[model samples]
Target chain A: MALRNAVAQAAVSVRYVVQRFSLALLVAAAIGVMLIGKADTVLLERARAAALDLAAPLLEALSRPVATINRLIADVEDLANLRAENARLREENARLVTWQSVARRMEVENAELRGLLNFKEGPQATFITARVVGDSGSAFVRSMLLNVGRSGGVTSGQAVVTGEGLIGRITEVGESWARVLLLSDLSFRLPVLVERSREPAILTGDNSQLPRLAMTQSLAGIQVGDRIVTSGHGGSFPVGIPVGVVSSVGEGGVRVKPLGDVLRVEFVRVVDYGITGLVTGPAPPPEVYGPPAPPPRAAATKAR
Target chain B: MGDFLQQLDRWLYAALPGTLVAFLILLTLAPVRLPEVLAVAPLLPLMAVYHFCLFRAEALPAWLLFGLGILFDLLQGGPGTPVGVSALQFLLVRQAILGNQKYLVEVSFTFIWFGYAVLSAVAVALSWCAVSLLMWRFIDPQPAVFQYVVSLFLYPIFGWLIGRGRGRDPLNAPDPRVPGSRP
Candidate 1:
């Protein structure tokens, strides 16, 4: 009985030791992974892409029921608001009829001006419509996974938009999936121009619902309700894509109300404007451009 | 035949709980695009980790916890690329719970919930610190705060589900530390 008790105690001790050793090893491994991941190695990127490719289909399957339920709820809400919605739509249609004639006149005048100026037309943009299959859903990151990827001609750096306005851009692409970094992500930045003053500025995101404008050349004429549009500075996005309107300006600086409702982004248009070459395009001939033009003295004086 | 059957039974008993944990992690990663839910989705897998660590420590080994955490970080891509920040946080939580298992094992539901709230807060704070350190910038803490509150509310629902799956009423189950009370 003494020997048996000794053996049992020994076995228990061995088990305890094994468990403790494994636990320590796992902790070490976790730290090691963190260190390695800090490198942002290509291997990690490939692995992430592969994992996302495999998971996208499953996420699509899981989301269908959720989508259906949401649609049903929306249908009920729509039914309740049907009469009011119809009246609003009628009013909007009447207003749109008047605006349509003005738009036609503007289009004719803009074409005539373009013809007079001998303006060069930009490349036509092609779009790929995709469904959002997955999202990071963490407060720490704002990104969504699309069902279409390389197979669907979706590429990184393409602008993602909805019918409403600019939503974000594709950052990572796999064979069958892509990740879109929303405009509300902390790292997102874009060059924008105010429609009224043509003032250049940077639109920056701080992971809030409303992104803010920064680095404006002049906020002189900028005010609440001013329209903001892409400046096409980087050539990643086309010029004049309406982004948002200046919602508020205060000690906190200018905040924009993004035209896109990111919360309800069911389908998105991934647009490639073929502007990648423009960034790397050769400089215009010296004779055609002559010497560098002098900075506007008025702008410099305003800075002083 | 009896020996083979017993071995299979042992394997199932050991693997089932961990597999369920993995399933919940996968479910959390799925894109259930409920409006505004994405901004503050409850950390369902954290609840699973807390549940298994408190009631069935033997099933939730350290390596399994680490693996789940790594999967979560990878799936939830971030600005600086996710490393093992989540894994470390989970490991810390599991270890803390395991160390205090003696007191925690027999606690009532309210105490367990309170314990979870505290541990989860610690985990989120640690994660925030790790991410901030990784990015070399202080990240906004509002999202983590919102996530914490959402996860707290989700705990009881998940706890009830987990209890139901184990074929025991969470409110009336015998003390799990007792030998015969568990499978």
Candidate 2:
């Protein structure tokens, strides 16, 4: 009786397998037809986005230990190499002091110059700090996961920057995690203006460490080491924020040396901008200089 | 009722090995970076299918293979891409091997690996072309070329290792028709 029962159970299982197999085949065929009729990049993108959503929290947890170990190793190395580092630090400090003095004098001079030349602050921006927790190291795309997410007020398209300069923008936001598509990603494009020449160009990444500067009107006035800043042409980033410096120049193109260290990023700031409510409002005008001069309208009427 | 339970146990047992094989293949494929040779390893799923077809054909049917493909597609994070297409290709190859089991079993391991390499390459190329077409532009071909060559180069070594390890498992037990093998 036991043997007979076992055989019956086996037959039931086989039946289940057959049923499921047929269903899967049908689904596969349906998918194939859809794929052939017209490829769906959006659907595949959604699937990938879903997978990333699931993996983000797990990746954040995984990155904790690596960060801890890296910190510990760096501490140990610092201790072991204390004497040399001390000398290096001393030299750096001295240079910083000199720079500080120069900076102060330059700041006073700049303020005076602004008063004379009427230069003005561009826009108002708010910021929130976040930490980098995960990196997707695929060659086809460049993105890193941040611990801050929707809960922290990070939303898709919000700009991320660092002490050095512009990093990337938030592309995907989960409840407590977000993905930043770094400026070096193949899909990322930013409007930029050269600091020296003010010539506009589109910075495009090709999944490489160095993103290329495209759409340049003329490379004649540009030089290596020239500063690049957000143009604010798209209203995405506040203008004049440092993006990167030109590292290479060619007949038709240039490459940027990104300010942020894409390889070893640990923390980033998510600029809140908080301007969702005022999206259509004109940006507040710059403060009047030269001992609080008359309002622009009054001055214009007086001149007339 | 008892018979149903027994069948459930058998199917569950059969599925475990394939799942483990899939997991290991994924683990190896996960951290592959360049500047080191063998950066992106070969089409690991093809190897998995090949193994099951050779040793435990009943465990991994075409449907399971297809599901595995779709799962990988989802995980690879490139949407609109159908991983099932390549998986279906693996199923076809397995079926071909099964149809000529008697003749296929007689071939040497080297020939078997060579056949797998060709089959896997074709499948990979097809899936890649499908994705490229879907995305609406031709992406650079360097990455695909790198993945194909590396996978093909390593398949033989991996095949040999799997063959040697298949010795102790009852499911991987040599066919009763092979001379000197116990039933």
Native contacts present in candidate 1, fraction: 0.56
Over the stretch B1-183, how does candidate 1's per-residue lDDT look in tens digits?
966866676677677778887777667656554546445567887888888888877888888789778877777775633668778877887899988878975679999999999999998888778777877886778888988998998899889888776654233445767776742
Worst 10 residues of 1 chain A by lDDT: A277-286
Q: A22-65, model 1: which lDDT tens digit per residue?
A: 77778788888877877756767776776676667778787777
Predictions in order: lDDT: 0.80, 0.68
lDDT tens digits, residues B50-107, model 2? 7678767777776676666655554443222344555566566666677768866668
**Number of the top-ranking candidate, with DockQ as the measure:** 1
In the order shown, the candidates' Cα RMSDs to the true structure are 9.1, 10.1
Positional deviation of residue A61's Cα in model 2 after best superposition, in angstroms: 4.0
* Tens-place lDDT digits, model 2, residues A165-191: 998887777777777888977678888
Specify the CAPRI tier of model 1. acceptable
DockQ for all models: 0.45, 0.13
